[model samples]
Target chain A: MRQTREFANPPVVLGYATIAGPKEGEGPLAAYFDKVINNLYYYEDTWEKAEQKMFLEVAEMALQKASVKKEEVDFFLAGDLLNQIISANFAAKSLGIPFFGLYNACATFYEGLILGAMLIAGGFAKKVLVGVSSHYATVERQYRNPTEQGVQKTPTSQWTVTGAAAVVLGDGEGKIKIPRVTVGKALDYDMFDPSDMGGAMVPAAFDTLLVHFKETGLVYDYYDLMLTGDLARFGQQILVKLLQENNINFGQRLNDCGIMIYRPEQQVNAGGSGTACSALVTAGYVFNELSQGKIHKFLGIGTGALLSQVTTQQGMAIPVIAHAVAFESY
Target chain B: MAIDKNEYQKTVEKIKPRPPVLKNCVLAFLMGGFVCFLGEVLFHFLRGYGLSEKDSYTVVSVVFILISAVLTGTGIYDDLVRIFGAGLIVPITGFANSMVSPALEHKQEGLVLGVGAKLFTVAGPVVIYGILSSLIVAIILRGLGKL
Candidate 1:
């Protein structure tokens, strides 16, 4: 069965904004960020509150940038790395918009995009706001260790992006149009290591990309860019090799958000991972390029490792998923 | 999936870069030695102040604990661990850090349930297992009735 939904009328990306942490702000894509918090606390008492604040602010920023208001948005869809998605839930509480909390791990941002677009195209809603955020301190304390703990990180581990990204999608003309969404399925290759998120997530990315290609009957060159969410450098290498073995050459078109966000010297080990990694890149860099007609058709895939602290602690294998949203510019 | 878990794991293992074992060992050795050396220096310094031998050891330990707590609070201990690896982890300072960091992290949760309960989140296991193993060893020595 085809996994992609071809929209009769595409939902346009009306406005988008990105708020990144200080570390991400110092990275190469710093210019694309809408705001960068100078400190990890972001002036909040706790890291959790800091994340919630970012989520709320980024959603508001997207609306303000689009010349839209909270009342005008038909639905708000959001998620994050926090437990019970407190970031999105608290943000929604303040946003006061009709909300749908979604979770697909790091792929949550694309899931939001997909659902928002679907709502718009299906006449369920005229305008939808989608957002996702992740904080390094919040995730580290929950998933790994205390932020101040002296545990050493493995080389394959990724740094979580301490930021948030939100987009305003409307039915009318927008900067870019999302025409299709290929929702991915959770797949596990018995990847159990929580540290090597790229290892756990690569299969899902590979599976989704292949499904999108086969279901849509489109080749790799059909899009100007086929971006993977946050596979980092190692996962990217393995993915490139896997694609080659399958006789599908992505050439130079395959780019990973994790690898693009930070330089190797940033000491992030592998690279950036987390929901915000892909969201920030797509909402800021890719959206800008699409809006400017730099590349007409683009396929952005958000890859996620759907593993939790409980699952990791219990020695459970990581199941991963990737969702792809294809955008076209007139 | 085209590849099973084992095959995929092999692919990952092949692509994943190996951490520098030798370099890490050398660094860990130097750092761990430095930490121990500091402890010894503090012990001698305390003894020179006319503190009892037992009191000097106690003072050295307390001083190290204080330093580690300060470092962890200032957010420098984790970075030092990244470079030094087990050097920071195998000492009393590490124990102090493990305790202090969790307390600091959970301070927002309030005193009783948050800081007090979570203060031993990391070190709790160490204390439990440490005592268990030591008890086992002591029992074996008693069974031997010597040494």
Candidate 2:
């Protein structure tokens, strides 16, 4: 090892992620809605609160696993899909730690972690906590009408997840080391559709990931897993087809976080969106595997669509951005 | 699974739109009114903090801006907007709230280049028109020697 003071030998992933709502097969929320005359009137409302709760719970879980108290953490960095970070604010109020709230729409998970690692590596802080939260209801209310009920989702629509995930970082913990980060340029197709955020963001994702590969002189085969947040089957197909056209084959390692989160039996017409979709899956599924040392290198990419209701109302097109962070167990 | 003509017509008849329910109207009124009440309460609290009415309004504006900026930066505002829908945004505060957020969001792109220039994104048109109208009004008043 070069120096314990500089970097952890293995860069251990000490923490995990969590979700508040029951899995589709478990039937908790759907059952509650069924009891209310098969109406899901409060799903959004309930999901919003539960989403924040899960973020905090997940953060606590990770902190506990790392054996670090809330006070010992140097900074709390997080983001969400809400206009004013309601979940993060409430969570921070309870955690009572210094925090820097960030937003990159859906891409915030990677953005938060990358910034957290940067702060740690730069000696701004020894131990940094990075996390993000998302809810289904909170998103619909912001982008659509409040009083409208039971609007059928389009095939392109991705179901939002009510969850959050946090990861703790320090000087040397013998876990995964965050190696590199690539920032993407924002690309707006002027297409106002919100149901297909992945389509809007694919260009940015391709651009950034390709640029990272080129600049670092790395090949697509170098990373074992390359993932994108919220892009479901259709979007993933699009990403794959596009990359293949570009002669950049990501192989089977390329996957979408949204597609992985949904169970086939759930009848989720498309897949999942929302900040939590990426956060929890990465925390629960991806991090779980990472901790087991099954995967050594991963490139986590998050996509965010920059669409405000006012912009849509004013007939402005939705622009999207994507960011990526590379990770490896040293 | 082709349907008979008569059955298709009957199904279409059954799918006819119904009138708005009294309960829906009542729920909308109560929820919308409650949000207004909260706004008024916040305004009054700010007023009680020893500021003039105009100053309080400005303070409210600043508070709303900072709140949205911080929330947008932290990724919380998106959740609030998602759940509350227009319930939180349709009020007067929504306009200014939307304006400052994107500015703060792109601050890292370049504070001088991004934040300063893009801060007026949502409110830019309103501010420009407001100044133009005020200038026209002032010119009219001066021509009439009413200053």
Candidate 3:
């Protein structure tokens, strides 16, 4: 129906937990994260295994925070950037919950959230766990070059966040509630350069945002914050221009998770990316703000550049997507 | 949405973030030069330790390669390259990085199939061409000598 869905009964955010690596832990939102592992390996032999461990940890942490047992959770909705989403699969295996693995690249967190919220709102499940994880080393090797390769990074390249975040969605009342969700269509603006993912995904972010506003009949300033998943500096600039062209300006309320994750001097280049970028930011920063009544209403738009090595190698344009969820403080 | 190629290109050109050429170049120069300087220091050190000039040069090259591989394993070489840009690549350390990086990356696939198979992904062409060109030059020299 090319429209946003407003749930009759909005799902409540029972609890959320964020765990990050050393670099992200050192960033601005370090205090917001629940657990920050200084070691990248995190007692695991490989980076992939470490990411898997993080997913499991965050999921368990979220469940514990919500006072829900693993058996009480109806389904685990999770995703990651790795091939076959091995991290999520392994974590799901350990959690012993019915699993629905998703792949929306960087926007996977929101994808999980929307689906989980729907399950709860539709009365299909009492509780659903939404989780996402991405490791810097793992994503670096899978998406681009290995860390040891020492390949010179383009200034436009965004650093993949080595972190994981999980949220427990329930049918009960809570401090924060997800009222509506806007699912975006896959749009390709003929962006080919993978190194410039922010540039590639900005148009999709704008498109979904515009549609969300139109379908929901919500003004640009309706929410206290309009957060894009991982647009970084360059994508944020492009998004502002795109919004301006449409005669809608979010002004100071607009901030990207990518740009917010790291400081300017951190040398993260364009800033943080991966599924965990927005996941951790929302779970830690935004969730806290909403709980404290600092932000009454907020919109989190997760943007993803659906590019694989195979698609890029085949000379296909990068397909981008953005999904937004409206969260309000109860 | 599909846009015309020319229109898409124009938008990309207008929006794409420009790379900082001057800063990157300076970093590259300093880093690359620093690596070369370290190599020079190693050469002199080897010579001081009683090695001949030629032997010292060889020893320095080997040492630089070993140091680069070790640094890559510890995950320090990548950071150096990140800051130095092309500077680190111009040194002998870059070659070591190119060889070891792929091997380490593919290590998850196991030793033989992963590391052994993909070991030369980057350095393979260089090694093959090097041996081929040297062989060709030697044959040409022999032919000229006969003549």
DockQ of each: 0.83, 0.02, 0.54
Regions of candidate 3 where Cα sits further than 4 Å from its true position: B1-9, B30-60, B105-108, B129-147
The per-model lDDT (C-alpha) reads: 0.92, 0.66, 0.90
Candidate number achieving the greatest DockQ relative to the actual structure = 1
Better of 1 and 3 by DockQ: 1
DockQ of 1: 0.83
Best TM-score among the predictions, by candidate number:
1
TM-score of each: 0.97, 0.63, 0.91
C-alpha lDDT of residue A215 in model 3: 89
| iRMSD values, candidates in order | 1.0, 13.9, 2.3
lDDT of 2 by residue, A85-149 (tens): 77887787778779889888888887887777777777788788888877665676566632122
RMSD of each: 1.4, 15.6, 2.9
Model 1 over residues B1-147: C-alpha lDDT tens digits? 375678778988999888889989999999999998998998888888999999998888899999999999999999999999999999999999999998999888999989999998878999999999999999999999975
- Scored against the true structure, residue A62 in model 2 reaches a CA lDDT of 78
Model 3: lDDT to the true structure:
0.90
> Which clashing pairs does model 3 show?
none
